[model samples]
Target: MKRTLSAAALVLLAVVALPTAANALEGDSYGPGSCNSITPASVARGAAVSYSCSDFWVANQTVSITIDSSAAGVSARTLSTVADAAGDIQVSIDTAADPAGTYTLTATQGTVTDSSDFTVLDPADAAAAAASASDPSAGGNALADTGFAGTALPWVAGGLLAVGAAALGTVVVRRRQQA
Candidate 1:
């Protein structure tokens, strides 16, 4: 009877703990203040770019924005602003002096940081992108579909946990019957 109670207690603990573990895993992929996207994801070498992010900051908190590039002769640029009451930060940066390259835009508030990538194109490519942007069929500056929908892993993990718990319960019941 004690063994049965112990087994039951263990199962109950696992059942209670599963959701918290699943949430932690989900948080790794979709944490607060994660940069969702940047508007006009591709831009002409000397155009303005804007991005908005929310939920990663508190009202009136100072958020630091950084644009970093690995292109030769380009230095990282940094900007700071306060989040609004809605805990959102939006900023526009002029890339007039930035050369054609891929850049990462990051936001930081205290310990939380998130980043997204954007591209700056030469005149010829920029014109092509602009032309495509106007076409309804062309998804302008969208991230490439990597074929992973990103929402399945947590469910899979939880399912596996449930299966394991069932197997353990079956073992415990069989042992009790044999005893």
Candidate 2:
């Protein structure tokens, strides 16, 4: 009984300590930036679109920005800028010369990189897109959905923890009965 309880306690301790240990191993390493988004995700041919990124950048470091499109005859564009003290970046690019298509904007600093996609629309489509963006009921802007909206990982983790607790309780109860 003593051995069983000790083993269970050790297992529980390891489970709780694992996350902390992993965090320690990640010390000072810049993770990839997130909250990468483009405002006015869909734009008319001559409109200006804004790109913004938050977090995960090395402070005050130079960041390389690249805009690439898979559309035929569209050459890639490159620019360089520095991230602010809070590791955030924002830029605007004119879509006047860009053909109607989807473009991906990537920002890289040190080992961290983030990317977002926006669309340059034809005049007719751009009007429709603008209308949709203005109406929240129409689903708002077309920013990438990076949320945990439909993930099952949380449920799985909770189920596992509950199972572990139940198993430990069963072990303790069995030990008490045997005593």
TM-score of each: 0.63, 0.65
The best candidate by TM-score is 2
Compared with the true structure, the alpha-carbon lDDT of candidate 2 equals 0.81
lDDT of 2 by residue, 1-179 (tens): 67677767776776678667867755645364465588977788999998887766767999999999999999999998888897888888999999999999988777767788998989998888778877778989567568758676786598579758866786878879889
Q: Can you tell me which runs of candidate 1 are displaced by over 4 Å?
A: 1-17, 24-34, 129-165, 168-179
**Could you give candidate 1's per-residue lDDT for residues 1-179 as a string of tens digits?**
57666666777787678778877865745655445578889888888888888665777999898999999999998999999986788888788899999999988888877788889889799998778867757866445568898797998788678857775876777788989
Worst 10 residues of 1 by lDDT: 28-37
Clashes of each: 1, 0
Task: List residue ranges in candidate 2 displaced over 4 A.
Answer: 1-33, 130-148, 152-165, 168-179
lDDT of 1 at 97: 90
True-structure lDDT of candidate 1: 0.81
